[model samples]
Target: MAVSTRTSSIGGHQREPSGTLRLSVPTSYGHKRVLPLLPAFRARYPRVEIDVHVSNRSVDFAAEGFDVAIRILPPSDSSLVVRKLEDAAFVVVAAPGYLRRAGTPQTIADLQQHECIQFLRPASGRPLPWYLHEDGREQEIVTAGSYCVSDDVTGCITLLRHGAGLLQTLRFMVEDELRDGTLVKVMSHCAGSARPVSLLYPHRRALPLRVRVFIDFIVEKSTAWRRAKL
Candidate 1:
């Protein structure tokens, strides 16, 4: 069945869109990227109630009954409607103190001498490889860390701020830190990897009005922001 959008009104006065919107988003990205934009969304659709779930793990929309899922990586379900939103570029960063003590890595080989902070999967406890591009090609290097953190990307920012070690994370998350000289981008010449961010929802003949408008609102607004940036 299609969920039709209806504008809420009081005493025949025209009003904004009204409905409940369930949105699932990743922890770090949601706070850094999506959360700030939501106030605009709420203002546009005044009566719309949003239930946002922030998690470091994935949510199964089909079974979990989520109206939408915001993910950094590509959507796993091909049948669902997916919109590619951002490049979500990453940078290898570290506190200046750490770099001063351990020395900055100029290349992948140099990383072996530094304490590379690695992020392992919370569920599987497996260390993921880092993807870097340099010398005209992309390379995947198995990473090891003296200080290992599991699951959360935001944790990397916290640790790096304290002069922990080198960590590769989404650039947007650490923009303030980078700009304020709290963290420094290391080996920027070799930093060329990013994940695709997407808005995911199950396929249906008729999309919910709230979902439709929300997607359009954010996508259009984000496009404009990027344009202004360039």
Candidate 2:
């Protein structure tokens, strides 16, 4: 059976197609994790238009009129529905040349002596803390480095590849380079500390068709993404 419905715009003065859904995700999403699911999403919903905004900063979903957001951090408002997607692992990586020059740091404490490349949040102008695990305990190390770059993971990867310094980055970001032996993981003891990835949507009595469809699609795709590794 086929059914049709219509919804008035928030302003209540105009009506538009409700089948369109807008999504906001980190720009890095396309390059690493979310890119693989695009073709499948399009094939499943040919009529649903997906508008993707690639950004590093937090998105105001209600104010900005985005239907859903895939984010790394949890939302502040209790009114939003947050779903845990996965625990993403991060590692300390350095280019082969960099390792050769400084020598690989076999222990977390050894990081104190090497140059580090830091990723900064442009909105806050603060460098992200490097997280590591040691002896069954997790530690957030405040690193001192001469080089700091704004949310440019690609540039950091480039710097690391050229033997610039050590970079704390998600494993997925450097998987290929590690596989090819261009980059090597440093501080094996601190390798597994990771953050949780999440999907968030505004709380509502009922979700519109478009938002509902996309959320379901994301859940299905992400599940498959995890299962494939097994």
Q: What CA RMSD would you report for each candidate?
A: 3.7, 5.3
lDDT of each: 0.80, 0.76
Off by over 4 Å in 2: 1-18, 134-136, 228-230
lDDT of 1 at 181: 93
Candidate 1 per-residue lDDT over residues 3-79, each given as its tens digit: 32444345977555668888998888788878888998888878788999998778887787788888888876787
Model 1 residue runs over 4 Å out of place are 1-15, 224-230
Q: How well does candidate 1 score on lDDT at residue 80?
A: 77
Cα lDDT tens digits, model 2, 88-205, are 6788889888887888887777878988888887688899788878768887778778888886567778888988899888877787888889988877666766667788899888
State the displacement of the C-alpha of residue 127, model 1, in Å, after optimal TM-score superposition. 2.1
Candidate no. 2 TM-score? 0.82
Using lDDT as the measure, which candidate wins? 1
